[model samples]
Target: MRRRGGARRAPAAKEGGGAPSRPPAPPQREKLAVSTPFFAVIGLGAFSAWRGMFSLDTVRVLNAYAFLIAAPAMVLRVMSREPVAALWNGLFFAAMALLGVAVLACGILLFRRLAGLPFPTAVSRSQCLVGGNFTFLGVPLMLAFMGDRAAAPIVIALIVDTALIVPLSIGLIEAGRGGGSPWRIGLRLVRGTLVNPFMLSILGGLALSLSGLVLPEPVDRFLLFLGSSAAPVGIFALGIAAFLWARSGDLQWRIVMPLVAGKLILHPLLTWFVLAVLLRLDPLWVQAGVLYAAVPIAANVFIISERFETGSRPIAVAIVISTALAALTYPFAIWAISG
Candidate 1:
């Protein structure tokens, strides 16, 4: 009876073993493996661009498909499935976006005055400081890091940037150009936001969510199929566009250096402070906000400049440099958020 109470002994090591094996060094931490898919997509895009896998016209078509078809489907799928309570986060997203824009806009204004930039140039540059590549770069990166659950916060942030920040930038640029009635500008902003395919999809999704209507099985499956294509296609398109923009012309160090620094560093820091420290949002939300802030300036900056017939060269240079540098800065941003 006493012998039966003894504890079981561990298995003996092999004769040649000096000590028990130490679990393979915990798999070497897999530092780069986590980011492998993201960087792979980016590398493919770069190669595509360098090899001319897609022409300019073909690239535009691909972008349109991603934006209008694939991306909107993903947005709708996520938003429609999200609870109405989750949708309330849009207000916080809008607030954070507005705060980031205001902070950066002020900095840009001060820099513009000190540098003696023209009004149109100043406005365009300020827009670049605030606007981000949320859909193209931000969405894919977040999906890569956080998976499908990230879509909700990302979509909300996209809405805020597209609806509020974008219009404000456009209005400022328009105001700088000449005179326009405030009412007209406001109306245009509203109409533009409402009419956007991306925004419209989000609204439809919200409406469905609020209405408590479940998507039919066929519809749901269709959306999932389309949504699945958004990340790869959008990232590839971004790479191609970035390559073309970088080759557009010679870099202007004076303007580009500041723009890149502000976008990749200052914007994210301010966003993190506002969302994580001040508002105390969910960690995921804070991370999503900061990540969106850290992306390069949206391609819309150049389009808006062209539309308004304002400064385009500087904006293009800023986009190219910021995007290229982001290949480095984004990884750091991810690590910061993860840590």
Candidate 2:
């Protein structure tokens, strides 16, 4: 019978005896490796803070650089190059918006009932728990670990969090405080959102992309240079901020522990379930969603807490503890999503 069809082509594995192809190291391990440098820079910042290398004024200057210059430049550069089509990842956007709203609502209700917090305080606490530091911590970590594929998704998530979740949460807090009228509060939020640096950069970039206009080579290079500084500087400032918070003697374990659990564990678990298990979006988007979800509470949350005369102390503690714990949780999140 033709020698039994040449022995079934000699089983490919036996044919070469090439040692089972060694199932390429667990993805989590690879992901952890990729994130090492980013974490190291952050650690360096913390170490510097511990050493008293950064004054409050110095930290403020660093924050200004990252927020006003580096971050906007980076966003502008990245958004300008992205295909207009990349902005319309409908499933990703829906998934993010759903997650944000669900988490915010549930968090508010839970904190209000379980903690017996006042309505305004409950709203502020919920905002702190859900509003991740995607602008500084998430963007830098993603760019460092995922490379260029991270740019567009990061921007999309930022938009959702910045334009939608943040403004909504803040508006609720303001309303709970019995602010002027609901309409006036909303109008103020709208105007402020429009003028925000992050929003401005996103709008400008989209406008450029829509117009099909390319920046001059030198101008583009300038943006690239400025944007490159954003990652390190922003993360470094965060490190210092964490250091300061830890020394403040304001961290109530009762409050900080629960908030940390919510942000570092609960939020990411929900995101993975929705994006990876349910929707089954592209792996990059899934990774992006999970990573951002796992990020620590935003510094802006503390600002919001202070502005509303809610408890900024608890918010600050949550930021420090959650970020510290993220070194472990983030890699696991990556592994879970990838696997």
> Candidate 1 at 125: error in angstroms?
1.0
256, model 1: CA deviation in Å? 0.7
Give the TM-score (vs. native) of candidate 1. 0.83
Pairs with backbone N, CA or C atoms under 3 Å apart (clashes), candidate 1? none
Residue by residue across 113-148, what tens digits does model 2's lDDT show?
A: 999998888888887667898887788777766665
Per-residue accuracy of model 1 over 79-145 as CA lDDT, tens digit each: 7775555455554666676775686579657767798877766777777777888776777667666
The Cα local distance difference test for each model comes to: 0.73, 0.78
Candidate 2 residue spans exceeding 4 A from truth = 1-30
Q: Measured by TM-score, how close is model 2 to the native structure?
A: 0.88
The RMSD of every model to the true structure, in order and in angstroms, is 12.0, 10.2
Candidate 1: lDDT over CA atoms?
A: 0.73
